[model samples]
Target chain A: MSKKDKSFEVLMGELETLVSTLEGEDLNLDDAIKHNEEALQLIKLCRERLDSARQKIDKLVQSADGEWQKQPLD
Target chain B: MAQLPELNNTLSVSQITGHIQHTLEQDYGNVWVKGEISNLTRHSSGHWYFSLKDSGAQLGSVMFSRQNQSVRVEITHGMEVTAHGRISVYAPQGRYQLIVDQMLPAGQGDLHLAFEALKKKLDGQGLFDPTRKQALPPYPDRVGIVTSPTGAAIRDMINILSRRFPLAELLLIPVKVQGEGAAAEIAHAIEIFNQRQDCQVLIIGRGGGSLEDLWAFNEEVVARAIAGSSIPIVSAVGHETDTTISDFVADRRAPTPSAAAELAVPDKIELDNRLSNLGQRLQKNILNRVERHEQRLNAIQGSYALKRPVLMINQASQRLDNMQDHSLRMVKEKIGNYGSKLDGFEQQVKALNPLSVLVRGFAVLSKPDGKIIRSVNQLKVGDQVQVRLSDGEVQSTIDSLNSKKK
Candidate 1:
């Protein structure tokens, strides 16, 4: 897998694991710290993915020559 | 016959009917009858009375509480049934009736078969697998509902979800839930929701209804649509006992549409309580960790290595003490040596004492005013002088005065 894809997978896995861990009781401090760190990493990865996707969409929309246009945020 | 005498005998209807009832009960035993049921009535006394009819004839049937309790299928009009009972006469009513002992359905209905077929088809596709199901998001950002816009189910779901989790955004994907083309519309709505990505979770359902009314959810198209969606779907089609293929394919199945809403979103109050609990737990964990580290630190600080400052300082203290003793001894020795040198210098000074000079017997002269006369210029004509040897002095007068430049 590409780095982005790998990161995406890891992000999703980390999110799933975090949710499961949070659903349970008896959390160790070490585990909590580890999960929190993982969640932060996943959130960063997701943001990056979203930004890249937005960039790709913008590029596609810009290349298209048509009356329909994408509007820019104020 | 001897009965010919009854030509003149009078008899009441009840009396004659009781006589015939006694005679029929004595003649026939219990028998089973196959016929179509009609005009069924259930009395408050837990008894069922209906007319059992064939194409050629009809007869009244009665199923008492004791025998009716064993029948599983409901007795409805025009139901083909086989009933086991004995033909009996009602003495009071003067009417003949069949007392049914047992009954069984003779054929399956079209709707029941259709339901089973749909259930089997969805089951074969692993759509009903519990492992393939995704859990509902604890706090969905948006909840999409697929149903009739003006339906009671929608209203119920809205009311429930809003009351339970008011923070969630609700989006309605209105579509016909019944009649022709409803299944297609529902499928299209689900696809649209998936494409829009406007909802975190989807609840596809309608309120309770008859088999035909809820048939849209049982359609294969709707079931596949639910199963194929990227977003997790919750199916709540009918009453608790009612099942549909959509329910099977959905990630979660709720008994009713309102229940599906409840399942789709969590109660804000409960979540707040849980978050507060988590906060408390986090605090407790941190405090316990700090306490444990503090105990370890206290144990380390209270060790013998730290408790006794002398242990660490003992070598330095000993070195200081040794240096102090050595310095004191050197000072004492220096003092002794200085004392001897001082005695030698004292002896030398005594050798050069003026008293020793006096013991050498040098004579001295002085004037009477206590002036020493060292030359003849000191001797005036009227001056008085004293001549001194080493121990004594003599007073004398000068006869002449002389001036000298020396």
Candidate 2:
């Protein structure tokens, strides 16, 4: 999935599901390896999403054109 | 006559007044009076004197300065009030009046009524349905706050949000949280937040206040606005004990403005810990998976087929050699039997040889004409006779014939 579409929750959910499959008894060697790889990718994505976040504040303003706009909450 | 001073012995005014005073004090002591206050007067001594009057009658009352200070409601003329105190008679005036120790506005009217009415109306409309509450996003990109621009509530919320989750952006839509147009202003701010896409959540509230001060939050307009907002709204109006209509209708209700700030976003420390935990779990789980697979691989590699391959080959070759030795031994035994049979046949042939019989001393006789004669008459003509023995041939035909015939 695209990074924009991959919410932390969704990626984490998929990662958990994959981990369980990898831990399951029925998974063959090749499939387990594949699941492990995918889980790592999800972890990386989630970590990046968390680490890169920065806090901000904004003020919402209405323009003469009858549209809403955001300005810095100075 | 002197009949007990006319049976209704006219008592002295002092006696009658004292008796009346005693009766009034005893009977009307610890009384509760409910009426509207009129002729209210605040004495220069910080005392209050008011007449608790309804349409029918009025009772004079006095609350000492100490008592007035203790009373929660300001005693105002025309305000309905309930007065509580001991009733004592002003014996000189022959009137009984209450010495008021406490007074309360008969009901927490206006604001309280408005709050209740709005709550009921909204509740009937299902605006306060628990199921209608939106789930706040675990991680909101931005939050919109509808509150006063400069207030303790805002300060508290800002500090909390910054410390809790710096990852979240805040959208502060400053509005009056009390007074004349506060309700409309709050509603407008909510609408603005709803129209904007930046804020995923909203916190609309103010600090603690008296019911009147907190009336704006109880306003129907604000309640409906909060209920209608697309973004989830957390209402943190007044203190913990206070509940406003907005509180009922909002997606979530925080007891205080500071609590609202806490509810707005997750604590960064907690999120950090959680993420680290999740990372560790992932690592451990993946490692376990690898370990299991490695074990399987080791098991296969340790199997007899894969291990000790040279031993297998040696065993097969050894069996082949054993078969070869067995085959060779069988062939040799058969050949020896055949050789023994051949030897016996050769001996038999040797026994039947004529050369061997001749060597046993047998002889043959023959005439000179190369015909052997056995009869004496044939031998009479002894011109020449020849005899053959095992060693040599000889002729004695005449002598042999005479002796045999006699």
Candidate 3:
């Protein structure tokens, strides 16, 4: 998969794993923290990708309007 | 009115009784009687024997097991009934009795009819829909109970609630649960509990009894009160088999008053175990975090960059030393070779000097006017000239000279 799609898949997988782990209530403190950290990173990456996509859409809109806009996606 | 004289060789007692029984059976065939049933007995063989009586007259009745099995309504003592049967005589005892085959209730009270009509009406309204019922709270903060203050249901509710979940507060709203105006009183109690806002769940019920005893709960007022309450209500009226209108309209239905209490709260032991498990999970998480950080720290400390701090510096220093030694040797060799060649060139230049040539026994001839003499024609007679020798110079005047030969 492309890097963006791969990241998205990883994020979704981590979310499912987190839900199952929390629901199962069998995780040790260590495992919970590790999973939590992984979930947080996945969330951050997903958010970043979403923000980038939003910026790209904004750029497309501005280009359609024939305007030179300097928008930085963070 | 017979006037015949009795003889010693007359008919036996059995024959005489059979004759009388046959006559009575033929005379009173297929009769209907209305009377109160008394001394009712149900034999193990499923037959019924009872006496149908008025204020003064009474008659024995027998319902065969086969015919009695078809009786839909319950036959009980003190119940007035109208029965259709054939009057027959038993030859063994010569007793005449009614052999009933069909029966009907002589009279039904107004209260019983009203109870049945209300029950049917409420049932048709879908008030007893199980899908509309709400689940009891797992842990109610406060439980409100509406019943008679002296009833057994309240006691059962309180006992079960306290034993199962002592943390829950019980709020009892004492009201008459039966008889006249009991329905209104129960409804008012429910309204009061709802308006107070302190109770999270409500239980409305009473002990089990006959239809009349539970008529209050069957009332429309009580059912509407339960349905209108904002709080979730659990109806536990009467026994498991007895149903009331309030039970149908309430958010939940319990088989008994004690069961309602059990449903309203959760077990404390189970909750405690859960909390402990969560605590353990938290600790494990913290320890795992620490271990991961320590592993990262060890990895960093063991990295090559830190272990060999002077590798780059040593290599650079050695290179600089080798370059200096190489440059020094090159310069020394070049300077030494160039110095010897320069000394030889200087010696040749000195040998070509005029003074050195004169020293080697060569002379430069010139006229007396200090000009070098190249030909005799250019020289004048008696011209003073200076001559330089290897070790000295001579002054002389030239005489006239001619060129004799080339």
Candidate 4:
């Protein structure tokens, strides 16, 4: 599955689930390795999402016509 | 004499005055009195005497300068005020008055009473129920803020939120935090945020202020708006000691705006540490699995079933070597027997040798014409013969033969 679309929380959750599954018994080596690779990918994606984050701040203002809209704030 | 006994129950004026003092002081201690101030007198002894009255009744009041100094509002004649203190009795005059320790403008005092009344009404409606409080999102992608644009509350919240988690977008709705219609403004901002539905959480607060300054958050409008919000709101109204009605109805309460910001987001450093730990565990687990499999393979390879062919070959070679040793030993024994027999044959051949016999004087005769004289009857009178002895052979004439009786 493509992990780029997943949110940080979702990716972290999937990584946790996969790691726990790999920890369980009765899994074959092939499936274990596959899950390991996927979990690693999820970790990378989560780290990137966290590291690349830059906060965006905005102010809600009313126009002369009385329409409310967001204006970017520093 | 009977009337004189009843007259003994009459009390002294001082004792009666003391009783009245205790009764009035005990009953009216720690009371709040609201009235229009009249007959104000600032004594040279740092005490002010006044009377609090509405249209129907008036009560004598006195506030020492020490207590009045802390009163923020200016108190004047005919200005409505609320005074808090105990009743004190002047024993000599037999008069009781309120001893004021704190005073405030009538409007601000009314706000406190109103706060209590609204708190009770909303509590009865279960607006402050824990079950009604929504759980704040663990990770919010967007946060809405309702506060004064120019205040430290907004700045502190922004700084803290950015430091903790920079992933969430902040949408601020700047509103007047106090004064006329401030509560309506705050309520409107909350409604707007709810309508937008983009923010996962909202922070509504202003920095520490006087009760009147923080009164907007205690208003019913703001409290109801916070309670009715679909998005979870964190109320951060004032200092740690100050609690507002909005704090009660909110999904979560923070003592200050900065604390509310912290409550709304997860720390990125903690997440990073968790991710690193999980990665290590995963790698360690996989490595352990591979090592176990390798051990299993080695065990299988070393098992007797896999080595059976080489074992069988070794056993066969061992048996063949034993048999070879047995046959070689028998052949050696037979050769030993033949060697003994050959020695016996050599002795027997030596005994049959003619030279060995002739050494004892034995002789053999042969006829020169292939005839030999053996007996007198078969032999003619003369015959040529050859004689062989151990040392020589000779030809001679046969002269006679003697025939003897058998």
Candidate 5:
């Protein structure tokens, strides 16, 4: 899938792999540090995604064009 | 004719009616009658009177306080009940009435025969089978709520979902949740949700109420709607004990509206906590790896070979250094021995050189025939002799030299 279309589950998989790569025995110190840095960035992004999420209520209202469009709920 | 002696005999009305009543009671001791109750009334004396009517006829029925006390249910309009009593006649009114002792509601316990029939039918079709139930998504992106917009249920659900997980979007499809046309509205809303793919799941219900108030959810249309929905539907029809047909046909049944909200999405806080736990594990793994590397470093640093690297190198180089001096002395000694032997050989070679005799001022004579005159007997007296010096040779006739004995 496209990067932007990646779900939280996909991102979680990536995060898990990154962490394991960092901890792997065959990994060199520089590569391990690099993987750890990338994992930390992913963790930060995931945390932000979770913390900043807000539920929005809306209704599917039929407009004059005979199409259902989203309108904010009261 | 055999006993006609009483042709002119006239009896009193009370005595004749008493005999008739006794005969009627003796003929029909007890009977059960089933019909719809109409024109029911409760008298001031705690007596219940009604008419049991069928399409063909109507029977006047009366349940006195003494007899009606045994009846479990009250006789009401349009209620078909099977009553147990006897047929009796009132002589004064000259009309027979049924004296009901016990009454049992017949069509159903409380007008739910249709409900049972529909449930049986739908169940026969496997609509309510557990296997047909869909598994709800663990993390729904959006949830559509098909309920009355003005109800506390929607408000409670919205509030619950928001508080539990704010990640999922809520799409409210407003509809009447009760009364006329409510079932159609509910079904329409579900259809819309399915048609538009509005949300991942649908939560359909109203607040708790009586069966009459909650009839819309019990409707066949609503049940069919729930069964046909492409999206998984969560029915939160009424209180926990109240199960509507919608609840039976739904993919999942939530006892309360707030519980449906809880079922529709994952709790973000729990997920966040899990993510944080994962992050900690990730860091712990890295720390463990780095600690292993550091331990290797400590091992190398504390090693004896590494601690005294110069000594380690010196031990290897000392073998080569000792061999270098030995090889150098052997080479010089062998060369000196060869040099003495070469001088002896040079002296022997010099003794064989004729040029050495010239340097010593010695001369040797030979005959012109290149023969040395070793003996006078071998030489002619007039032979010329040639004398050879170190630097030059003179050519002459050989003369007799002396014979020498060596």
Candidate 6:
């Protein structure tokens, strides 16, 4: 999934995986640099998401015709 | 009807009492009664003896420890209650009483009874089994809330959820929390959320209220919906002390609606700290790897193998110089020895010199043909000869022949 579409849970999971892989004893410098860059990017994305999040509230209402619709709650 | 009673056969009081006990116990094997509690006594043995009475009549009641252990509400004198039990006769006292198994406050006793009954039934069906409970997602993308739209419970939940984790969207299904169709609406909302599959977790709860006001949460329908939900649910009902059937059936239980919101999602501050830590660790690891590689590079550059060619050339030239010096020394020593040998040979040549003997007055003779006449027999008479002395030579002819003795 695109970075924007990935859930916070998935993003955090990927970040953790990268960090641990980089921490291993035998990884070459090239691979370590690559993983480090990717992990830092993920951290940036996660922080931005956490900082910019605004709780979106939606109220679900069923119409008289028996169809359910959702609208933003005030 | 056909046989006449033997009135003359007098019956003892115990016999009459036994008959009365059998009839009364058999007729009221199980019954429910509503009355004001009077003369309540909690005995040391943990049994409760009380009287259930109206103005006209009173019924003796005894609730054993085992049955009353599960009763959550407190019972006091003059409090109205609804009690369920079988009738039993005390033969020795000639009295019958209600052996109460359950009791609740009179006003909402029916709802409480229903709650207990549904709790027991669903528990027996293993709907509340820990194995059946699903794990809540660590990071919920959306939280489905089933509650009244305008209640304080929803407000509190929204406040807490927004403060802790705003990443999750709150999907609210506004429903009547109590009145007639509240249970059906709550159940339907839960089912709808499950069908949509949008919410990762659900919080079903309400603000604290009287038992009647919170009856919807205690309904069998709501409990069954929670049990059958594909999404894990956190049930928050009433206050910290109040518990509903929904709480027992849910995957998790929170004492209040705000607590349920907290349980539904993770806090962002903790995640932020963790992300920072991971970033630091990544940087450290990369730096360490680079430093190690650089150190290895430096060691390789300064290694002996890289400088070996020049060192080998220098060593070969030094060996060549040493060999040259050794050969020159050998040549000089040989020349000196040969020079002394040459001087000795010069002295020997002087000793054997005939020319030097001539200097001492030795004469030499030769025939006219330049052949030296070493014997007198070599010359014949009338042969010309030459005589050589140290300084002069003379030519002469032989006139007489002389024979020499052998």
C-alpha TM-scores of all predictions = 0.54, 0.60, 0.46, 0.63, 0.56, 0.64
Model 4 chain B poorest 10 in a row by lDDT: B372-381
- Candidate 2 chain B minimal-lDDT segment of 10 residues: B397-406
Which is the better candidate, 5 or 6, if ranked by DockQ?
6
Chain B TM, per prediction: 0.59, 0.56, 0.51, 0.58, 0.52, 0.58
Worst 10 residues of 5 chain B by lDDT: B107-116
The deviation in Å at residue B256 for candidate 4 is: 2.0
- Complex DockQ, candidate 1: 0.07
**Alpha carbon lDDT of residue B22, candidate 4?**
90
* Model 3 chain B: lowest-lDDT 10 consecutive positions: B271-280
DockQ of each: 0.07, 0.39, 0.02, 0.52, 0.36, 0.63
lDDT of 6 by residue, B307-343 (tens): 6976898999999999999899999889988988998
Which of the numbered candidates is closest to the native, going by highest TM-score?
6
Tens digit per residue, CA lDDT, model 6, A2-72: 99999998998999888888888878888888888899999999999999999999999999998889999
How much is B91 displaced in model 2, in angstroms? Answer: 30
After superposition, candidate 1 runs with Cα above 4 Å error: A1-74, B1-36, B39-45, B49-109, B124-126, B304-310, B318-378, B382-406
Those runs of model 2 whose alpha carbons end farther than 4 Å from true positions after fitting are A4-26, A41-52, B1-34, B37-53, B57-79, B82-108, B301-311, B314-406
Leading candidate by lDDT: 6
Q: At residue B13, give the lDDT of candidate 4.
A: 98
Native-to-model Cα distance after best TM-score fit, residue B182 in candidate 5, in Å = 1.8
Which lDDT values do the candidates have, in the order given?
0.75, 0.80, 0.73, 0.89, 0.83, 0.90
lDDT of 2 by residue, A1-74 (tens): 68558655566577778777766678776776677777777777766766786668777666899776778876
Q: Candidate 6 has what TM-score?
A: 0.64
Model 3: how far residue B358 lies from native, Å = 62
lDDT of 2 by residue, B1-406 (tens): 5555664678888899899889888988876678899999998999988898999999888889987986766567799976778888887887878898867687754344455567778889999889999999887767789998777998898889888877678888888888999999999999877766667889999998877788898888898898889899899988898888888899999999999989878776787676677667767866777787789989998888786887888888999999899899999889989999999999999888755666788655567778866665665644577766667777664544444534
Chain A TM-score for candidate 2 is 0.71
Against the true structure, what is model 5's DockQ? Answer: 0.36
- Order the numbered candidates by TM-score, best leading: 6, 4, 2, 5, 1, 3
